[model samples]
Target: MTAVPEERVDRFATARQIADAVLLEGYVLYPYRASAAKNRLRWQFGVLVPPGYGRDAAEHSHQRTECLMEPRRGDRLAVELRFLHARRRTVQRAVGSRAFETVEELALADRVLVPWDEGVEERIELTFPVDELAAGEVVRAVRLAAGEEQETVQEDGRPVGRLLRRHEQVDAVLRLSVQEVPGPYGTLRLTAVVENTSDWRPPAGAGRDAALARSLVSAHLLLGLERGRFLSATDPPEWAREAAAECRNEHTWPVLAGGDGRADVLLSSPIILEDHPQVAPESPGELYDATEIDEILALRTAALTDREKREARGTDPRAGAVIDLADSMPPEVLERLHGAVRALRDVTGAPADPADGQPWWDPGGDPGVDPDRDRVQVGEHSVGAGSRVLLKPGRRRTDAQDLFLHGRTALVEAVLHDVDGSVHLAVTIEGDPGADLWRAQGRFRYFQPDEVEPLEEP
Candidate 1:
């Protein structure tokens, strides 16, 4: 996840923190009520619906991740496939001494019941020697046992309704294999593939709800190495760039993780991430809604009326947890969640303290940099704002639309530097009616230094 491994063990707690965040992402949203429309449309990330079920191209029945790793003799790799199993909770009202009739809601003296979908965490771990994966493909069977449970709903100790909860038997397959290829240097490139092969089919004209019942929700893999190191697939070194590019990943994204930048662990996630991403330290536990900030949601949730709070608590146990967390969190904790900063540095590239100088985000942090007067050297000529250039659209760096700009003249609007130290020239098409407007709005097409040809002065 060598590049990402087995379900998370204690050693991978850091990665597990992020993994848990991903697992519960969007499990529930703000208002946290069953009646809320947003609460019903859930499970957005890493959901693999039953094989061939939905028309949405973005949602798939299976996914694969390919990454590069370097293994030594006797290297052992571990992989943990993590996902959520969805269970249906039906609220039933007692009609007879031994029988109950299904109902929409059940009211008791202390609590209210609403029918909702609940998630059960599922993890399957497999460990193997690197040679074993490379010599022959490894396929592990994934199964979530089908089960049912009944929770008696009582008002003052008298049975009023029953909560019937059950989950479908879901089956899936995890395949791990590898290919050996030569790297840009004398080193070797070990490309690994992780895939999902499930054997579930939806009945005639089934909807997403039906397919999702037997699907793997928020599925991801955590990878670890005992005697090997993994390389960054997204930003490989100059030597391994070509080899890394050769890896074809589908739907899934993998990134280096854990241990002070050591490549021993990788997280192959359905969501895109930079290498070594972590859950924010300021985060106050799971909100189930990743899109919104914790502090804001905390305040809003704490503000809900007593009646609204009751409904939220009854919606799902998770929402109840969120409510409890928000209501009981200390002021110090809430203050910590207000903001966070990372990679702070000045224009001189010197580390700066956020507590001291002007914020790094503000233009006054350092006066050394200015897009308006800054100039970049291109082919013996100094180019800056107002300079002219012809779009060359280099084969290596050009996008699909870049081809249409081929041979077109453009006016440089700014010379920008990215965090990665790459220089890009922002420009607008020459003589376009809206060029001035776009320039005023600071919106323009960007191209690398190599993708443009300097236009000689007339």
Candidate 2:
């Protein structure tokens, strides 16, 4: 029987860095604005909160996260826990009355009142820390909490109204454990779990509680390894070296382990991260040529609408420099800008064939008399609709779905192309049937062209 390999980490950042990236995932985007539709869902990943709760009530919500890690024996592992705390602020706005007299009613006039502008204030009040966990020990739970901030309204230096505290106390809990696995280099498995243990709930019948509840229970975990070396991809054992080489990249590689026989496996990343930089260009001309192409591509892909282009020039400070350069250009040169934009848009927007590196319209005339003979050639056989194909293993996959579908034969129902012009085979596997995955109104199983091979007919 073929041995199943363990999952491994390829690329990783420090726990703190990972936490920061996770926290920022749904927080905001470029041109950050509260009104941006993209910002509607603030936190989307790893959320654990009650069904109906608000940010204010989240302080009382409990959330937990579990992470698995592998450490070498005798090595001390340090785990750092971190999270963000939001603080509320109070501000006072001046209220005043205005009076105006109409021409017809100039003899008498009453007072007209204008609404005061709303004021906002924000700050980070306090920082809470969770207890650190050591190697081989289990962290049952660690709690975190923040106090509420008081708010008040004042008129002419005298308190006119005392508003209740707007900020609610926040709390959370974290748990950790380590499991040992026997291997060539005495391996230890680590698991870290974080939980929101607050018992707070939002007020019943609150209209926006549902949306708030979704964001309240979410948390991000940033994991980092501080000790030990990860297995090497290029230098893996003889039995597993081939698999490792196929999967090797700058960030990760498949590890090899020797068992009853030999098997290609996966190992987690080491604590220390390494960098691989591109080699320097051999000639100045070559460098300049590449740079020129990159600049052309960048301008073409910017693809901003006229209104957006104008808005960027008006609002973005960086655009000022470019605008100044364009303004100083000769009239004849400036007149060509519009044409250049259109030309670039046309060229970049056209889809090109991946196989021949030519546009779809330029499919160099038919080479054979049979027009239907262009079906994909897989292995030693050609496959088309109604043809049978077997799923390939260990190619372009990091999930269990690959293992589940590996070696399974499927019937190709159709050949489809995505909006980007990539091709896919629409297939239904034997013994396993399900609804097709939909994206942009089209159905697909995300099987890449290379993940399948045609099965020859008997």
Candidate No. with top lDDT: 1
Q: Report the error of model 1 at residue 111, Å.
A: 3.6
By TM-score, who's the top model here? Answer: 1
Please write out the lDDT profile of model 1 over residues 290-400, one tens digit for every residue. 778888989999999877778888888888888899889999999998887878844676546666854444344447668878898887888898899998888776788
Q: For candidate 1, what is the total of clashing residue pairs?
A: 17
TM-score of 2: 0.39
lDDT of each: 0.80, 0.38
Candidate 1 lDDT for residue 173: 80
Please report, as a residue range, the 10-residue window in candidate 1 with the lowest summed lDDT. Answer: 1-10
